[model samples]
Target: MTRKFTGLLLLLCFACSLRLAAQAPVQTLLWKKQLQARLDSLQRANGFPGATFAAVLPGGEVITIATGIADSVTMSPMRPGHRMLSGSNGKTLFVASALLLAEQGLFNLDDSIELYIGRESWFTRIPNAHSLTMRMLLNHTSGIEEYLEQGDFMQQLKGHPGHTWKPTELLAYIYDRPPLFEAGKGFSYADANYILFSYIVEKISGQQMYDLIRRDVIKRYGLKATEPSTKQTYKGLAVGYARKGGPFPVAGAMVHKNKLILNPQFEWAGGGFVSNTADLAAWAKAYYEFKAISPALRVQMREGVAANTGKNHLYGLGMQIRPGGEAGMSYGHSGWFPGYLTDAAYFPDLDVALAIQFNTDNFRLLKRAPEAYLLDMARILATQVNNH
Candidate 1:
């Protein structure tokens, strides 16, 4: 409490602050190099065709690293800016857009989906159509079975890889099917719910879901590298790879003439967007920080039931929350298309975001899931930030 002691303490604190500020740049460079080396080793050891990783620090610094070959045949190197299918991460947009519309007093989340699409003749055929609410679809509690799990659907998709399917066409596979559970009852992770939700979004807004998402989510957040996967080809898109024996059977490069071998348009609302790691990381940060939506709605998005998808995992609205011990509570989404796999997470406790994308889906060749790689990468970054 003495004046002399207080003055000495203040001087020491100022000196420490100056030292830390001077060391920040050196620490940033070292961490980036370390992250790049780690990614390179992971890709080589795991047989991934290529990988891109991005991280956003608490201080707003962005780090991105790319490794391995982008195109197997052409031998092109993967760049940090190369884009790939983000898979189900697209659901984040669907959920966020719906929330924005709801925030604008356009519609209620608890409203029956039938209120929007009831007039369509085929809507009545959908399981639990009359009782399904928009909230059920957002949280995957609609009880609709997954059309992707149907054998005939996959066979048909394999038969015509180049076909651009309509939403109704995709719904036919699950039409008149038994409900997994009554609407708003037990939880079931089904893309069909989002597909139906997409219809609701369009009917309620009188605009395409893609356009709304681009305007409100992508452009609004300055995610310049993110775009809808409606098109078959995109500039700076990395060529994806998969095993020969899978349902797709596209052994080598999954892209031909810069176009996806399979038309991914059917993924429309189910989850369909392509983005690079930097953009994905930025999106994750903006979203989790509640910049994309109101904090109240974001809290509702995190209010999820136990998701049986993984140990200690929960699926809320369109966001996935998983425990990340030292990294703090993690919230985000994982994406899996035929040839690409992605994982993006934002750690609220640390105020950091990280995204990882692989241009290959050969899980057999890898030792762990994409999210595992993401958490480990996050751990490394967290150490750097914490030390500083």
Candidate 2:
């Protein structure tokens, strides 16, 4: 009787294990299918030629999804490895590097701009330039006007495609202009802050901003696809598109115009990095896992900074923080450029991070799509991995 009982127990245990094993891959496959379906729907509806997505679970399980074409003109299908412009999303990388320096005690976060980069006289030709600080620059609270909004700036860009821009020259274009508000008084989305912050990164690190980012952040995290914009031509990079008559071009148009090919020197260190979904996912994982920076500093980076009441989307060191429900919150940054839109988010409680990018420039389409899709996909993927 004892022998018979032992055999039956072993059989039962084996069956249970088999059942669990069978269920695991099925769940993963189902999530992947659903994600693919969602991507397809978005592409058809929004006229985007291509989109890429990646997610990482706390346990380190990874899934990457690519749909549509990398270049619609070439009819090249989007690949997992193709690089795309990150635009403002690049700021997150800069912020991460800054935190690493802060961890080393290079500079205090609250230090004034005058302390590190000299006084307003340095930008004496530009009005109110001295009131800016390192913190304000990081948080977009600096009063410095944005160069991109200047009427002549865009014209100059189109006319002088190969023009190499100096940081001071870019700032000079907006010099003497009134700030969006007094320094540290309000939050306004200005690229000027990052342009200045890039200079500070160079001044403090004694390394060019691009090289510093590559060494301190990208290589440190083992990111394979992240590279400085200076290294590649935008035309050869992953194409960005908008709808035919819509706000953004369709993926096909992006490939046709070679919008991806351009020199991003003017925006270097501010919004010039290029990467793909997979690398971005890995970056968020390293960042939130505290592998890239100290845990203490990570907390500070995620913390919210005070800003305009109407613009409650307060800025952090190098990120934007939006308050969530009672349980916890999400953290990440969003980027938009001529032909690309990207956003990434990490849920601390869930231990999951998701990165999504579309090869389109249309803000209107983005407004139509729920930002929650990224979070929703992350949640679905995380739940599946956990259950397994």
Candidate 3:
């Protein structure tokens, strides 16, 4: 190109750069205020014991906000940093550990889990355990019966509120049941699948699921407030409540504002962790942004297995995906335990991530406080981000 033509091109590029630089500050301030207002409005409108929400912008700015009572008895207010039960969301942490092990040549995703934790036949049995693979467990395609759904599971928990369960003990309930489907024939969300994952990782890594999460996910990502929910107590933990007629496992407790605490033993790797909204939001940003995950493993995590619901919603190795969206897709998970319900997601097209936690599960009894509330929040956030 001629010198005169090159000089004009440079001037055009400089002008475009100046325009974008000038608009950046205005966009940042506008988004900060808008996101805060939206969260504040949600807190005011939603009725719950405690609520917290956190979000991260593409530029790495983090914001967390909270509202409502942390302790009804103590009348303590909730804070953004207060930790609460993560429930099944902890599955992702263990999945990451397993993936790390896979990278180190410790195990293969396609390896049969029976090669690791064969049924403790003297203790418990799984009819289809021999055919299940590490990938099946990670993707919830193992056909394992959900121990949590057993008729008497809550009764046993109520009878022994503080009983810490051995993995075998938890499996005992499902031992005699037939497989729900042939291994990988279908998908069902089963806590048993992840519980077995904890065993699978431990058997090979020689480390407990909690320790693996601490080393691979929490400490690695600087999730200061995140922790394995293998215990009932935390310094800044909040009280959890259940809706009226809800099945809460607390002994001699009435539904609706009745306190519920998770027995961490049975929870194991399935839903056995706790964290604040801030930590969860950080997770959305870090995990999806490929901070510590390898590109190959990231591909495995991204590929979806069609869920029983439909192709619109898919379940991947450790994450949930809604493949249909106008400008982007949603990938993350929602968690529900006795007293806590949480949802966190990231929208790649919009370059935003968010997490919302409510310290109560109001399913069945009321449509007003359904678990889908967080999903609605996600739609709202995504729309706003994508519009401009």
Q: List TM-score per model, in order.
A: 0.92, 0.84, 0.84
Score each candidate by Cα lDDT. Answer: 0.85, 0.70, 0.73
Off by over 4 Å in 1: 1-21
Best by lDDT: 1
The TM-score of predicted model 1 comes to: 0.92
Q: Write the per-residue lDDT of candidate 2 for residues 1-388, one digit (tens) a residue.
A: 6999999999999999999778766765787788888777867776666778987765566778877887766788886567777877788887777777877888877787677767545565543556766777787777667777764776676677667888877876776676667877776777777887777777887977777788888887888787777633543367776444542212224333554344666777567788887888777656655665677777777777765422356567766665433213666777766677787766676676778887776656655432455755665655555565
**Clash count, one per candidate:** 0, 13, 2
TM-score of 2: 0.84
Tens-digit lDDT track of model 3 for 1-388: 9999999999999999999778766776665566557656665665556688787766676767777877777788988887778777777777777787788889988998777776456323674877888899888887888887776888888788768888867767778688888998988888888877777678788888778778888898899988776556676777776665565554221122433454555787777777888888778666676546578889888788888644578898888886435536867777877777887777787677778887777643224432254455555656755665
Error in Å for residue 239 of model 1? 0.9
Candidate 3 positional error at 88, Å: 0.8
The CA lDDT at 108 in model 3 is 86
Candidate 2 residue 186 Cα shift, in angstroms, is: 0.7
Find the number of clashing residue pairs for candidate 2: 13
